[model samples]
Target: MSTIDNTFEAQSSAGVSGPATRGSIIARLERLPANAMLVRARILIGLATFFDGFDVIAIAATLPILIGKWHLTPWDVALLIGASSVGQLIGAFLFPWYAERHGRVKAIALSSGVIGVTSIACGFAPSFAVFFALRIVQGIGLGGELPVAATYINEICRAHGRGRFVLLYEIVFPVGLLASNALGAWIVPRFGWEAMYFIGGVPLILFFVLRKLVPESPRWLAERGRMSEAADAVHAFERTAKTALPPMGDPASFESMVARHPKRKMSDLFGKAYWKRSAAVAMLWMTCGVIQYGLSTWLPTIYRTVYHAPLQLALNLAVAASVLGVLGSLLCAMLVDKVGRKPIINWSFMLCALSLALAGVFHDASVYVVAMCCAFALGWLACGFITAYVYTPELYPTSIRAFGCGVGGAWLKLAAIFAPTLVSKTMIGGNLDVAFYLLAVVPFLAALVVQFLGIETKGKVLEQLEA
Candidate 1:
C-alpha cells in the first residue's frame, strides 16, 4: 500500500477517519512543487490586496483637492481622513470572526463588495456628511480584506521560500499605493476628485473573479477537519506541477505533531504561550499604522498647505515617497527568509526612527530636505510594515491564524483611526516637526519590545511553529 493509504488506515484505526486525514493533506501540500495554480492564486489574491492599497491612499491623494473645494477645516480634514479607518477598525474586529467561522475567501469577497459599492457612493456624495459616512462604510470593506487575504496567502505557501513568495505577492499592495497616487495625480486634476472614488470602486468586479478562481486555504480546511475538501484543494494545486513532486513526509508524524498542541482558543491570544507574541505584534502593527497613515494621508496636504507647492507638485512628491516604499518592500521580500523576521523588523523600526527624527530636526530647513527625510522614514517603515503581514500569521496556529491577523490589524486600524487627528493637532502651527518627533518614539519603543518579546519565524512550517 502507498504511504498515503497507510496514513489513512492509521488515522481511521485511531478513530480520526475522514475522506483524507489532515496529516496526508498537510504532507501533500508541503511537497507540492510550484506551478500555475499557485501563481494564479497569488495573482487573484494580489488584486484584492492591490485595491486595498489603492483605496487606502485614494483619500490621501484626493484630500488636497477636497480641502479647497469644500473649504474644510483642519478638524474636518482629520475626520474625513479618519472616517474610513473608523470603519476599518470595526471591520477588523468583525470580519476575522466571520472568517474564523465561515471561511477566508467568503469574508474577503463580501468585504470587497462592500468597499466597491461604497467607494462608488463616495464619488457621488453630495455633502461632507454624506462623503464622511460613505468613507466609513467603505472602510469596513478595506479593513476586512487585508488581514484575511494575508492569512489566506500565508496558509497556501510552503515554508521553504514562503517569505519571498508571500512578500512578492504583497508588493502589489505598495504598487497599488503608487498607482493610486500616480493616477490621482493625473486623473483627479483632469477629471475631478470624484474620479478617484469611481476608480476605487472598480474592484467590485474582483469580488466575482475571486469567487470563481481562487480556492480556500487547504491548511485552514485541514485544521477545521474538512479533510475531504482539503484533499481536493491539495490535488488542484498538485495538478499544476510541471515537475515530479517531492516525496511526501510521514503523515503519521505530522499528525502526531499537530495532536501534541492543544486546540487554541481566541482567549489564548492573551494566555501564557501567546500573550508576548500578541503584545509584540500589536505594538509593531500599531506603530507602523501611526507612522504609515500619519504620513501617507498628510504629506500631500502638508506640501500644498504649508509649503505652498502646486497641487501637482504635492501629489508628485507623495508618489515619490510611495515609490521608495515599494522599493523598500521589495528589498524586504528578497531578504526576509534569509536574515529572518526579527532582525529585519528590529533594524527597520530603528532606522525608521532615525529618519523621522532627522526629518523632525531638519523641519526648519528647505522643503526638499524635510521631504527627503520623511520619504526615507517611510521607506524604512515599509520594510517593517510588509514584514508584519508575513510574521503575524506565523505567530499563531492554523485554527486561530486569521483571527490573530485580524486582531493585529485591529491595532493598526485603531492607530490609523487616531493618527490623522494626532497629526493635525501637532501641525497646528505648521509644526510638522512635532508630529515627526512624536511618530519616532512609538517605533523606537516597538523595536525594543520586538528585540525582547518577538518570536523568530524564519523557514518554519505553520504547524511546526505552533508546536
Candidate 2:
C-alpha cells in the first residue's frame, strides 16, 4: 500500500483478537474516498462536538452575569466555573467505559442527553449551588462527546487527509466556542444570563439527530467479534465507495482471519506494548490541557479583571480572538497531513508559548488586550488545539481509542480545575503578568517534549503505530 493508502488500513499484526478479525473492517474503511457516507458521519459527529464547544464555554460566557446575579465571590464563581470541569473528568472516563462495552452510539446518546437536560435545568437554577450541581451533570455529557467523536471521526477517515477532515469536524468546537462568546455578548445584555443556558439547551436537539443518522464504529464491533453487525456497518461505506469512485484500475485484495479476539480492558493502555503511546498521549494531553483549558476558561476573565474592560467588550474581544482560532484551525487542517503531525505540534506549542508570553510581558501596554488575542490565535488556538484533538486518538487503536483519548481529556479537565484557581489568585489580586508568564513556560516545555519524544504519525498505518 502507498503511504496514503496505509493511512486507513489496520496493521498486518495480530491484536487482542489474535488472528481473528485482525484488520478486515479497517481494510474496508481504508479504501473509501470523500464519499457521502464519510460526509454524513462527519456532519453527525461534528454536530455533537460542535455543541461541546458551546457547552464548555457556557460558564466562561456567563460568569460575569452570574457573578452579579447571585452575588458571587471570586471563590464562589471559581467553584461554579470549575464544577463542570470536575464533572468532565468523570464523564470522560465513564462513557469511554460504556463505549468499550456496549457501543459508541449508546455512549454518545447517553452523554448528549445528559448535556441537553442539565443545560435546560441550569436555566431554571435558582441559586449558585443548584446551578453548580446542574453544570456537573452537564459537564459529564460535554466531556464524553469530544474524544469519542474524535475516535469515531478518525475511524471512518483514511490517513490521506485525516488531519484535515478530523480537524474540520473538530473545528466546530472553537466555532461553537466563538458562537457562545458572540451570542453571550449579544444576548446577555438584552435577554439576561438565563438566555445563555437556554440557548445552550438548543444543541440537545442535535443529539436525537445524531442517534438517527450515525452508526456504531464498524471496527469496534469487529474487534469485539460481532462480525455480522460489523459487516452491516462496513457495508454502508462499501455502497458509498462504489457509487463515489470509478472501478480501481487495479483491484486490491485483503486476507481474512478466523479466531476470537479477546475483550480489551481499560488497563491495556498501560500494558507493555501500549504504555509508551499512552504516556506520550497523556503528556500531550496534560500540556495541551494547561494551555487549552487554562486559556479558554480564563482569557475573557483576564480582560475583564486586569484590563477593566466591560463584560460585553471583553467577551467581544474573546469572540474575535476565537475567530482567529477558527482561521488557524483552517490553516492547520490544510497542512497537517502534508507537513505531518509532530512538526505541526512542535511549532504550535512553541509559538503559542512565545506569543502568549509576549502578551504578558507588556500586559499594561495600550495594545495589551489585542496582544493577548494575537498570542492565543497563532499559538495554541489554531494549530496546537487542532493537533491535540486529531493526534491523540490516532495514537491508539480501536481497542482503547476512547479510553486513551479520555485520559488525555481528563488531564484537560484537571487543568480546567486548577486554571481558575491559579487565575483567581493572581489576576484578581493585581499580578496578572506573573500568572501569564508562568503559563507561557508550560507550552514551551511541552514543545521540547514533543520535539524529543513525539512520534511522527505521518505516512504510517494508523494501526502500525502500535505494531
45-125: candidate 2 lDDT, tens digit per residue:
777777788878867788887877889887887787789989999988998878878888778777877888898899899
- List lDDT for all candidates, in order: 0.87, 0.73
TM-score of each: 0.95, 0.89
Point out where model 1 deviates above 4 Å.
1-19
lDDT of 1 by residue, 1-467 (tens): 77567546644442334557777777777787888899998888888889999999999888987888889999999999889889999888788889998889888888889888998998998989999999899998999899999999998888899999989999998999999999999999899999988988877987788877877888888888877667667776777787877777888888887888999999999899999999999999999889988777899988888888899999999998999999999999999999999998999999999999998899888778888988898888999999999999999998899889999999999999899988898778667888889999988999999889988999988889883
lDDT of 1: 0.87
**Ten contiguous residues with the weakest lDDT in model 1:** 10-19
- lDDT computed for candidate 2: 0.73
Cα lDDT for residue 34, candidate 1: 85
- Model 2 worst lDDT run, 10 consecutive residues: 10-19
